[model samples]
Target: MNITFFIKEFHLRHPVIKEIKSALIKRGVNLDFVVLKETILDLQSLGHLKFASNSDLVVFKTTKYFAEHLAILMEDEGLRVINGSKSIRLNRDKILNNITLRKSGIKTPKTITFHSSEIKKISQKMFPMVIKPVVGGRARDVKLVSNKSELEKNEKNDDIVIGQKYIENDGLDRKLYVVDDKVFGIFKPSVLTPSDNSNAFKEFKVEEDLKEIALKCGEITNSKIYGVDVVLGEDGPYVIETNDFPGFRGIKNAGKIIADFLYFKKNEKR
Candidate 1:
């Protein structure tokens, strides 16, 4: 099998990438490493390099702006794209993710999206909410505002953020990873909580219920390979967000699972 792997320099250091690359090669798969952003050239230019045409599939991992559109272009050219461009575009917007998930009967946190101009629409019920940029990853710029003062303090002029009712958990959360028919997850501490309960991750098992929710998330996002972050609330697990390219840092055998699926299982007839 031949696959075109899209990765940028910013993500070049992730250990999982190295592991996946090595594992895929061992399985008799050929990989063409391409920097999606660097491949652009004018048709009028003397030297115009073409995207690899012999690739069986394009396995993209970067969240770089405009990269998804490029992937879409390749898909339009008859190349199979893993975790399709539509899924990546949906993952880029948290507001869209929340709305679509809810409409699909998948439970997510009560959320609202607003910009600085629409700040007056924020209600008292939304107080003590968690706020984050509509497009971001790794929890960067995420904040929990328990009061009006905090909300105002964190608010920036013309800023747009997705505010969701903070689901209270005892620092227990799950990151569910999906690769084709393989769905598994990890229980870990919430990054938003005040406590460092990372040590308790080992105690959490991959429950059947969690797998069901994770698979539902994949269906909702139309992504065969993705991640769903679930916050275990008093009622049950409420999906926090879904990732187009989830970093499976400590999850057991994640690299092998993803690599093997792309190399072989995805094309297998059920």
Candidate 2:
């Protein structure tokens, strides 16, 4: 079986990547890498991807923009992409992710999305609100709106942003990493604060309720790999967001688990 990792950069320097590569090699699976930077600007490269590779699976660790586009192109050529094309598209947009999850009976924060043009019509909902780019990830362009001046200053005509009711949890965020059926949590503290951009990660053991929420979320997104962002509110755990790609730092054995799953599926297909 051949597995291709299409990423912005190789995780070769990372121990996790090494472990995954070693595991796949042991299973006689061929592992390959393609730099997304080399393809995003060259439509010709993407157009010829299917004709170029006879790989069994494509694993996307690239930009959501490229991932969504390549997913369709790859699938049209009768190739399977992990996490699926539709799921990738949904996960890329926070508005869509929130709507899909809520519609699936999964709980998420109250959100309102608007093009930068519609900011004038947006009446203030509450302070301590969150402004998130609909097409943003890794907390890029995410801001906390504490007052009118900050909200007014946040307007950007080019991008759409989601105004969400901020859920609080002692200045920390719970990120649950899901690989297929398994779920693990990482407690990232002050990562959202503008002062500390670094992720101070600590292992968070998944409780039964958190696991349930994560599974329900995965089912809705059709996600084989996922990260569900949940906050502990006064009532209980509230899932505010989800991501297709999250740094799986605390999940030991993650590489082996993913490797085994791929090999098992490849064998089943054969």
Candidate 3:
């Protein structure tokens, strides 16, 4: 079987990808990589894109806009893409993700989204909120504001922002990485706190409830491979975010699990 990975150059150096590549090679699966940043797409005609038509599956690993458009084109042409183009686009927006999760009867933090210009009108009662960009990752531009003054002082250049009620937690992040039917949990330091690499990324057994939430996320997004960021608040578990093709940083044997899932999926119909 032939498989193509649509990813950025930096992904080639990722440990999970490296292991997956090695395992798949040993399995004699033909592999191809297309660096999203460097690959050019001819929009004039779908017939010009021979690679899309030739591959059995495309593992979309990047979130670039151009890559998304290309994935859509491939899907339209009857090619299969993991975490499909619609899923990629939905997971990229924090507002939509939150709403979708809530509407689907999943628990999430109470969030209010608004334009940066309307920041001044925000009530002081909404203090002690976690604010972040509508489209962001890796905790970049994420802020914890305790008061209106702090909120006003936050970086305001973003076109949109989401303010979520801060859930009281033990300061450790509970990250659930999902690969097909399996869900792996890890305890890591909160990005808001100082990094402690020594104590980070220790894998642990996931509770059934958390597992259900993780799998439900996959169903909601129509994604086979994804990650859910949940915080164990004083009340209960609340999903903070979901990511498509997340870097499976802490899961044990993640590469083997993911590769096996892909191989099984490739041959499931046959």
Candidate 1 — which residues are off by over 4 angstroms?
37-49, 198-203, 265-270
lDDT per residue for candidate 3 within 1-270, as digits (tens), equals: 888888889989999999999888888899999777754656776442467678778888877647667778878877877868877886888888899989998899888987767877877667688988888877887888887767767746757789988888877788899988999998888876546556567898999999999999899988899889998887899999898888889787889889988877776653
Q: Which stretches of model 3 miss by more than 4 angstroms?
A: 38-41, 45-49, 194-199
Q: Candidate 1: TM-score?
A: 0.90
Candidate 3 positional error at 38, Å: 5.8
For model 2, residues 1-270, the per-residue Cα lDDT tens digits are 688877666455666667777899998898887666653446766543753268788777654446777777887887767767777888887888889988988877788887766666766665667887888777877788875567777775677678887776666688899888888988776445533425447776899999999998988888888899887888888888888856687788877877787767655552
Model 2 spans > 4 angstroms off: 10-12, 38-48, 51-53, 115-120, 193-200
Question: Relative to the unseen true structure, what is the Cα RMSD of model 3?
Answer: 2.1
Q: Candidate 2 overall Cα lDDT vs. reference?
A: 0.76
- Rank order (by TM-score, best first): 3, 1, 2
Alpha-carbon deviation at 134 in model 2, angstroms: 1.4
CA error at residue 109 for candidate 1, angstroms:
1.2
Model 1, 1-270: lDDT tens digits are: 688877777666777787888899898888888765574545453121246567788777865656667667777777777777878877888888888889988888889887766666688888779999998988898888887667877887686789999988878677777786577667676667756665655534568888888888788887888888888888988988888868776777778878877877436543
Q: TM-scores for all candidates? A: 0.90, 0.87, 0.93
